[model samples]
Target: MKWLHQILFLLLLASAAASCKKFLNVEPADRTGSNSFWKTRQDVEAAVINCYGFLFQKFNDFNSPVIPAVGDMRCGGIGGSIASGQLGQGFYTLSQNDLSNTTNLGVPERYHLNDIDDWGPYFESIANCNITLAEIEKMTTLTDTEKKQYITEVKFVRAFTYFYICRLYGDVPFYTQPYDKTPRPRTSFITIFNTLIAELDAVKDDLPWTATNPSDLGVRACRGSVYTLIAQMNMWLAGFDKANQSKYWKDAAEKCVAVKNSGAFELLPIEETKRIFKGKTKESIFEFELNRNYGNTSLYVNLGQWMTHSPIVDYGGNSDLYFVRPLMERIYPPNLPDKRRDTWFYLPYSNNQTFMFLKQINVADPTGYWSFEDNLMVFRYADVLLLGAEALANLGSNNTEAISMLNTVRTRAGTPLFTAGAEDLKDAVFWERQKELIGEGHRWYDFVRTGRVTDPNQIITPMTQDQFDRGAWTWPIDAKARQNNPEIVLNLYWIR
Candidate 1:
């Protein structure tokens, strides 16, 4: 069956290639046997779906090594340790922290960084979209309206790709067109951001509120996701680029309100919300859908179970790591109710039993292995609300309204209301986000966005020069990528 599928895919590629000259005088690596593959409305729809598949492929579990290597989540198991302090030394080594280079500690342990060269996968996905869009533009089979909608969807995905790279690497070699010429010069952070914002805003009105067809299942880009990205990008711009701080903050606040008023989404109830990480909720705005039967391949691994396990259970069953630090657990206010506390951590007593699993793995089978249905949420309605509240507080003159918006999140979590001053209210919002979004990979970005890593009270621990040296904020460019393209500059913030 796999071989049959491969043959069919090759035939489709061949068909696509045969028609490439009709659309653009360029040849794709794989040829489609004939032009019939993308000559109909359904054909164009399938092409858009192929673009989405590329998006998922670029970031799926096969690429899981990059998450811990780049993101701020903790790493290590019961007896296994991350020599430089956090789990995975890719970021740490780039940051130039002092760790034993003698053993597989610092640079030597980072074998994957050497292997996965460049942002090729991400760019390849973008190129796929560009090629598809170019084909669709010349496709007369699809109506004008159909072409407009499909083009909007493709542009949204492309913008998201650039946004993802920009957030991670800062100034990257930005490209929207197919790489036919020598690589274009790297765009500055400011120009890249402006371009992203323009692209998103231009297509914002063209996207549908929701996908109307099953074929559009994970294919079409919706207003909610684009607005969410806009809010995030605006927030980042406000923080990192001070000259444009006010403008982007205002833009973020408006985008947040747009999502708030869209009426297409709502927060799941507390119980259902807890099941969200497991991928059971309707509130997910955008999630990477994983299916075990989609070849029984492990889509992505959950670090939560591995991160919080105690030594007793670490060596056995599905558990390998345990929570070594109290940073996440301590972020919640001491008096916030049990629901909030229990949601974030396995209570000490709960983990006291030798045979018990210390943390919750969203989907565990009867025998206790991690289930494959667990969906990793990239954006959810709850996150949108929190972001809205933060944006409002940052740019608007409504402290009371901000508090009310925040209390909505707290009330849903069954926690007490926050009555702190404006500054404290900001802290309240920050802490709430940390607690609510823990383990979902937002904490480190929050710290960096606010420039609060060094704040004594803001972070769970003081930001050590060692931590900074370890590239906690900036991800290391893959070593081989730099070697392949000498123009690729390592992020100086992370480099020693």
Candidate 2:
């Protein structure tokens, strides 16, 4: 499966370049669309494969915390390599609680990730999805089921990408057909959410519970994958919309139930964490598939390479990023014996100031440094259970069901079970997620949704409920992106 991933990665760039057509009004630059060319099933698959490249560019092209910046680091519990030299200061500054003045972070010698907009990559991905959806319907060679499957898969990925955009940017460019619209104002979040839920409902059953091959586990959309995302979206909507908490909470819980009934996933025990992050397991619902050697190009494991520099077997090297030891030790649920603390990180220092995350440390190269085979987990059963717990808590008191969900996730991780009431149970669920999904990129959103995002250092100020409500939690659109599209305006709070 990892080897198949290598093939998929190669297709992402090579086949996509030759097959994908003009999209998003960029002068049809790389488009090579023709009826005869796109006549086969391979053409449609190639187009879908092309969409993955944009996401890979954001993560593997460089060691950008593009994923973490908007997800984990902003949660204010981050600290970076205090190594002899400042190898990764950009991440350090971001973790230290400053994303506004990235100049202060100092440009790295290599992998200079410009101010956090990186919107172009996400939009480019969206455009590809749009192109695939628009053209795949017209093909006469495929059966109705194949046609529906292709359309639903593309639509699901687009919705998934847009879901992330809306969370970080609040509003964004939304389109179904590529090159059909002009540069427009950002679409409202409510409109996008309503559209996504409807689209997911229409096609959720159309997807299989699992793919025939191991490589397609999360890389390709399945019934479990689609429902999990649908469930996750409703959970966010409950937090963002606020007024219809009961509606969204119910929707979220129902979707989670759909995934559970599918019987496609399970909670892997702590001792088997290698299978969890190596991905394509009973525990994994969706993961970003990547391999060490994808031919020709060196494409090393970016996550492990950037995070650490330690030369330990099944671990990382040049360990650059870490959690502030004392605060995390304080917050990681005392006396609970959470095994993740050991599997996910190591305390090799006497001062105990840093703890390196070891989830992606299994593979290594000839030099004995961590290699690129580890698959990044996006959604797993544990996440679903925790979200279910969170949604159940929102339903009100006397929710034995919700408390059981919390206990299920906790017990698997070798942590204490929840014996508390509804309110306390909700708080336990929230903190449990913080420990469980720490570096996998869900913390910041969880913090913002629960109104618990604050400066653990006390130096960086917290956004008030008023500011959070006003859509002020989003990142400023980078200047370069604004220069490219005149219709794109700035997030007002960031305007000087």
Candidate 3:
């Protein structure tokens, strides 16, 4: 039960120490109770798992569905209400980029929409990662190799957490040392991304190309995940730093190419939707696990709760949400022969009442409990392939390689290969990602990183350059964020 004790300790530490004073208000490292727990390999493993657990708790907070709310729904594509017309007001405001509305109108307290504004959970998780990284180096039980791997694993978790928060909040206070509590101002996300790129590049080779254990596949950090994260960070950096855009694009393309050539991952047939979405598979690069049999399942965190109706989930009559018709048609024109359209949806072009998305329909108890049975796919092979295609296209050469990567995903999805038809290669790659990765909490970030957030044709809620320059794309940091840290600041646009 030592692992259980370690898990409990981490959970209690995260909860008890949650604050905004230099990201967390923890006891001095010298006096912390966890100092005694990091003495064995099991303890290290437990801490690593706790790192991921903290993230899971953050994403699965109450009924928030934080990922999709911030990543997908905000793009202004959803058209229907969950039930009462009042319940949709907060979501509607969110979709319109109105981040100041904490009341959420008719949204009940149980739903916890405002949790999206809070960055404390992420910092708490990052704190755990920092603690584990500092403590692991002193342990004598692990060999240098074992210690290196464990250190790299914790680093990945920390870097991944930072990358995620950077995407959401833009600039954030960056810290790597253990239990450093000095109040620090937000660091340029560019600087953080650059540091992460170098840090990950140095340690990525230490991880195996793939997890040898089936259970750990996609659920644990691997070389594929590390490369994918680096590739993504490069693309994001490229978006904000225009002067070195070409260099970042090339780096992204190269990292993605490494993932492709590794032979450790491949796109599962689009028809194998359940196997792919159910978690550990050849297609998944990284995902968070949720198995109902283990009494670990979430109703609101997964998209199924909002996108499915009666047969899929006994939710009375209609689904709680539906993709806008224009957006649906734009991505999947009726004339298109993409299997994703047929395989992932019912009534693809239909009205809101009956248009149900089936991409994540693994219901644990469809007729009764109605809990979702799909892992939160943070990264997958197809996503990497598409990102590679986008990066290659941005570099303006290697057009053939770009098209090949783009078409590989298309071929698997039973869609026509790209031939540089009327659609530009870059646009084709972008639309392919929108089509293939729809409903998986990616669309909004895709818009922001690609400069499509200001393009009316690309997104429903487009932002003007002036607004975007003022941080219109970021969520409002909760007032609690500045409670103890005087150096902390909120997003300017949200305040205006």
RMSD (Å) of each candidate, 1 decimal: 6.7, 5.9, 5.2
TM per prediction? 0.79, 0.86, 0.92
Expressed as tens digits, the lDDT of each residue in 40-150 for candidate 1 is 886776566556555665555342534433343422112223452433453344323222221333433323433222566676667767767777888898777788888
Worst 10 residues of 3 by lDDT: 19-28
TM-score quality measure for candidate 2:
0.86
Q: Which pairs of residues clash in candidate 3, taking residues 3 or more apart in a chain or in different chains?
A: none
Steric collisions counted per model: 16, 10, 0
Ranking by lDDT: 3, 2, 1
**Highest TM-score model number:** 3
lDDT of 3 by residue, 229-312 (tens): 999999999999999999999999999999999999988888899889998999999998877765556777766567888877
lDDT string, candidate 2, 1-496, tens digits: 1122223333333445443222101122243435345677876776665665555555544445466656766665455545534446666666644556654466463544454565766776676666667678788988888888888778788888888888887888676665444666678887888889998899888878877677677677778888888888888888768888788899888777667767778787888766777777888887666554442112233333345544443344445555665556655644547777767667723123245566665553535333445666678888998888788888874367778777888788777677764338777888788778877778778876666654333213366666666555777777666654677766766555
The list of candidate 1 runs beyond 4 A from truth reads 1-31, 61-65, 74-117, 213-220, 296-300, 308-318, 348-371, 420-423, 460-472, 482-484, 492-496
Of the two candidates 1 and 3, the one with more favorable TM-score, higher being better, is: 3
